[model samples]
Target: MPEGPEIRRAGDRISRALVDKEIVKSNFYYVRIKDREEIVKNKNIKEITTRGKAMLIRFKNGWTMYSHNQLYGRWTVNLNTTKIKSTRALRVVFKTKKHTVRLWSATDIDLLPTSEEHEHSFLKKIGPDVLNESCSYKLIEERLTSKTFHKKKASTLMLDQTVFAGLGNYLRSEILFDAKIHPDDRPFDLDKTRITQWAKSIKNISHLAYKTGGFTVSKYIADRNKENGEPRKSYRHAVFMRYQYECLNCKSRIERKWYGKRKLDFCPSCQIQTGKIKPSR
Candidate 1:
């Protein structure tokens, strides 16, 4: 699944391609929403924005289209003359006179009132988006101290939409590694310095990944790895998929452990824990 930054970047692309442009033609291939295609046809797009992992496409009228690109869902935008060959099922398409914008393999789509876009179930429940300019340190710090989230395990809380909208597996691992905090630790277990690091890391890594196309390591490291002919996986992260590899900071092995259903990567020594963290593939 695409994280918040990825979704936000997609929104930026879609906005440039579709916003202010009239949807001269459109289609809704999903069985349930097929009839709703009429709603998007021939309308001027107002904006495209994202909340967490969901995308909202607003029309000039009082309506907005909501969609979430789960694991396989993708968006393609290009000149109508250009054809994108793909095996993914096409779910939605919006055509402006000069461009063809498509949403493929996505099913979580809905049309709702523009006035109530924020009230949409998925949008309503998610926490502040890291990429949103409104997400300030104070806002994140407040969440860190909130009772509803403070007690949750750091590993679990990182993926909770209500905790940090747009956070997901890979980003979770990178953020934890950057903060040097154990996933098993709750916010309540954090010292003031650790709490600050946690919050800052969330903002920094999310923004960095958004700017660098999902790579979490520093540009210097990434460029160095590239110059050295290292594969992307070797330099794109500090620890995310580098199991059995040396930690960038401490040189300890990057350990991979299963917590619930997701695998978390961390440096056993860099991220301190009193008890042994059971390792699994």
Candidate 2:
């Protein structure tokens, strides 16, 4: 599944291709909204934004188009002259003067008034967006200390979009590994300093992934790994998918535990459990 960074990047691409440009034509192949596609015809796209894994396309008017790329959705942009073979999976098309932007395979789509967008099921309860400039360490720290989320396990909370928008499974693993916090630890189990580190890690790792095209490691390390003939899938992250391998920070073997049906990886020596109280950094 595409995580927050991936979705945000998609939004950036769509924004660059369509924002401010008058849509000469718009097509929604999505069954329910296909007939209502005239709503955006000849209108300018005011802005395009992402909240976690969902994309919002705001028109010059008060309307907003929402789409979630649950698992298979993808968006592609090309010049108007470029030819893309038609497929049954095609979901949306926005043809501007110079470029054609297409959304494929997205099912959870809606068109709603921007004024009432707050009522969206997913957006209504989403926590601070880690990539948003306004979502700072102070905001995350407050959320961490809040009674509503204080008792949840870090492993569980990391995947909870209500706790931190844009955080998914891969991010959950990378952030916890970066902060050197055990997956089993709760916000209440962490000291003030540790909690601060956790907040910082959530922001840093998330932004880094966005900046580096989903890489959690530094450019130097990534380059070194590539030089060693390591595939991106094996080197793009720290503990995620690297289970049973040596940890990047510590030489301890990485371990994976099942959270229901999902997998979570951690380094036993680096991310010490709460009772052990070993400071990682």
Candidate 3:
């Protein structure tokens, strides 16, 4: 699944390639979207943005094209000609004078009135975008500790898009690991300072992942990996997909268990359930 960062990065790349460029043509390989080509055809793309894991391509005529790369969806930008690998999987296409932006394997594509976009089903349920500069830690804390959510497991709440949009499976593990909070614990179990610290972790990890292209491990671990000649991709994560491997901090074997069909990894020694909770700086 392409999480928020990957989706946002794709939007950025598409915006760079197609923004302000007049759409000379629009193509839809998916049956549901076949009739919606008129929405973007012969119009200019004013902007491209991401809300949660969904992408929006705003046009000069006040119409917006919304697409979500759920699971297997991906977008590609090509110069002059299309760079589609599999024609059968192609879902949507936009052709400008210099570039062609193609979306493949994505099923959630729709046309929406720009003014009514906020009422869209998926967009309406999403919480604050973690990567947005305006994402508020206080708001996140309040939501996490709210009466409706305080009883839920921390892991579950983190994965809930309605609580913090754009957070995916791996990100949930990394965020909890960085905060030194056990996934099974409730947010109410922590002190106020700890809640604020957890919120900070969410923001910091989100920004760092976006800025560093999905690297979630701290600088020390990253530098150590480089010095040891380890591959960049091998150490990009802290506790994600590291089952049975040594912990980066405590040297203990990383543990994994299924959390509602999702494999969650953590350092048992580092993230103990009962202890004095310390604020993560």
Candidate 4:
């Protein structure tokens, strides 16, 4: 699934191609979006930005277009290309004379008045975008210390968009590994200093993911790349997708287990847990 950084990057590309340009044509393949032709036709795109995993296309007339590329959605922007071939469903298209912006396979797309954009059902529920420069560390720390969230497993809390948006399975595992915290550890079990450290890791990894196009390898592994030795693609992450593989730091075998239908990866030695973590494929 595309996370916040990926979505933000896509929005940046689309914005560079279409922002400030009046949409001369618009098309939609999804039934929900087709009826909104009159609403978006000929509207000038004031901005294209992302909030968490959601993409926002704001127009000059106080109307915004929201699109969420859940797990399978993708966007393509083309300039001066006459023909394009795509195997994915061409869900939404916005065209100007010089560029074509397409959202492929996106399941959620809505046109809402600017006054109500904040009140959109999904947008209203999600927390602040972690990739946003203005994302509040204090707010997330408060969430960690909150009575309702304190008892939840750290892994589960990391995946909760309502707590802090834009984290998915891979990022969560990487973040926890970076913090040296077990996925099953309750937030309340961690000291305030440890909670703050984990919070900083979240922001650091989130920024690194944005800057490096989702690479979250440790400095040691990344340094190997600088030494003229290419890190194997299969061993890219410290723990994620490295089930039964040796840990990058301790040499102990990395483990994987199902956490809410999603795989959680970690080194048993690195991520200390209260009880034994049963490993599965």
Candidate 5:
């Protein structure tokens, strides 16, 4: 699934390309989009912004278009001078005087109100977005320390969008590994200092992911183009695929295990499994 950074980048692209222009044409693929014709025919795009992993395209008349590109969804922007291929599976198309933007295979494409009440109501249900500039550290700390917090494994909690939006399986593992925290450690068991450190690391990684256009881990390697270098595979396969591969840090054997339904990889010596660190008061 695309994480927060990827969505943010998409918003930036869409906003820059389509914000001021009037929508001359619009089209839809699936019937799931409510009032598709009304939205395309009447609404004028006011702005494009991202909330968590979702993208919102606000219109002048108060309606907003919301989209979440689950896994396969992708967008392509072509200048008016360029040619665009014709395809029936193309979900949503927005044509401007200067450019044409097409969204394909989007899991979500819906029209909604842009009212303050509606926006607040929607945001109220979600936790702080990791990539949002205004995301509060206090809120994150409070959420991490709240009563409902069980000592659930950090890996599992990170994937819970309710705990912190924008994190996926790959980011979860990488962030925990970067902070030198074991994926299996319970949230409450972590000291305040460790929790704060993890939160800051998440912000940094999220920014890096956005800047690199969705390529997270493999972007760090010095030689991404070596003759023997294969594009680092998806996060799951990159980390968990080679069970006996040497750890990049300590040269220890990387290990894998089934944590719930998902596979997780970690260095045994680096990520200590026991949650016995002294709490900072």
Candidate 6:
């Protein structure tokens, strides 16, 4: 799944490529949108913005096209000044004077009301966007400390978009591992200092990932050659896909468990479970 950083990067790229440009043609595949003909035939892209994992492309005339890439969806910006054959799998294509932007296999494509009332109605349901500068630490702290979240596993809570937006599976695992907190541990059992530290780390790492375009285990990989360096192999084997490999920190064997059909990898020595905790209401 594409996380917050990837979504933010896509937004930045699309904005740079299409902002202020008049659309010459718009095409859709696998989706039949009402009023799409009116939307595509004549309109200019005003701005592009992201909300959680979704992208919003605003038009000059109060129409906003929303899309969520989900897992396999991708977009490509064509600038070679050569016409290529359009594929039937293409979901949406926006052509401008300078570039052609093609969206392929997106899970969602919708037209939305552009009014603040409509926008707020949708935004209010989601938690703080990790990439938004205006997101408050107080809000995150309050939400995590609430009675409703007390006994729930921190891992499960992190996956809830209402608690924190822009966190995907890999990020949740990495954040918990960095905090030295077990995924199944109860949120309230965590000390206030640790909880605050975890939140801060999440924000910092999120920023880094956003700046870097995406999070890979490579960022944590150590490079030995200062002159002409190559990333150390051990760093590449961290919590992501290295299921049974030895833990880089403690040398203990890494373990894997199924959590709601998702594979979670963690080091047994590095992350010790406190005990079985009751689920939050």
lDDT of 5 by residue, 5-50 (tens): 8788888988887887877877666677745657655356889888
- Candidate 1 residue spans exceeding 4 A from truth: 226-230, 274-281
- What lDDT is obtained when candidate 2 is compared to the true structure? 0.89
lDDT by residue (9-66, candidate 2, tens digit) is: 9899899999988788888889867666777666789999998888999998989999
Q: Global CA lDDT of candidate 4, please?
A: 0.83
* Candidate 2 residue pairs that clash: none
Q: Lowest lDDT 10-mer window, candidate 2? A: 33-42
Candidate 1 residues 29-68, lDDT tens each? 8876666767766688888888889998888877888999
Q: Highest lDDT among the candidates is held by which one?
A: 2
State each model's CA lDDT, in order: 0.86, 0.89, 0.84, 0.83, 0.71, 0.73
The TM-score, computed over Cα atoms with residue i paired to residue i, of candidate 1 is: 0.93
Model 1, residue pairs in steric clash: none
Best by TM-score: 2
User: Which candidate, 1 or 4, has the higher TM-score?
Assistant: 1
Please tell me which model should have the higher TM-score, number 4 or number 6: 4
- Model 6 clash pairs? none
Clashes of each: 0, 0, 0, 0, 0, 0
How many angstroms is residue 252 displaced in model 2 relative to the true structure, after the best TM-score fit?
1.3
Candidate 6 structure, TM-score to reference? 0.84
As a TM-score, model 3 comes out at 0.92
Q: TM-score for each prediction? A: 0.93, 0.95, 0.92, 0.90, 0.84, 0.84
What does the lDDT read for residue 168 in candidate 2? 89
lDDT of 4 by residue, 90-117 (tens): 8888898999888888888888887898
For candidate 3, write residues 150-235 as lDDT tens digits: 98998798889988889998888898888888888898787888788889989888878887788898788878756766566547
Worst 10 residues of 3 by lDDT: 80-89
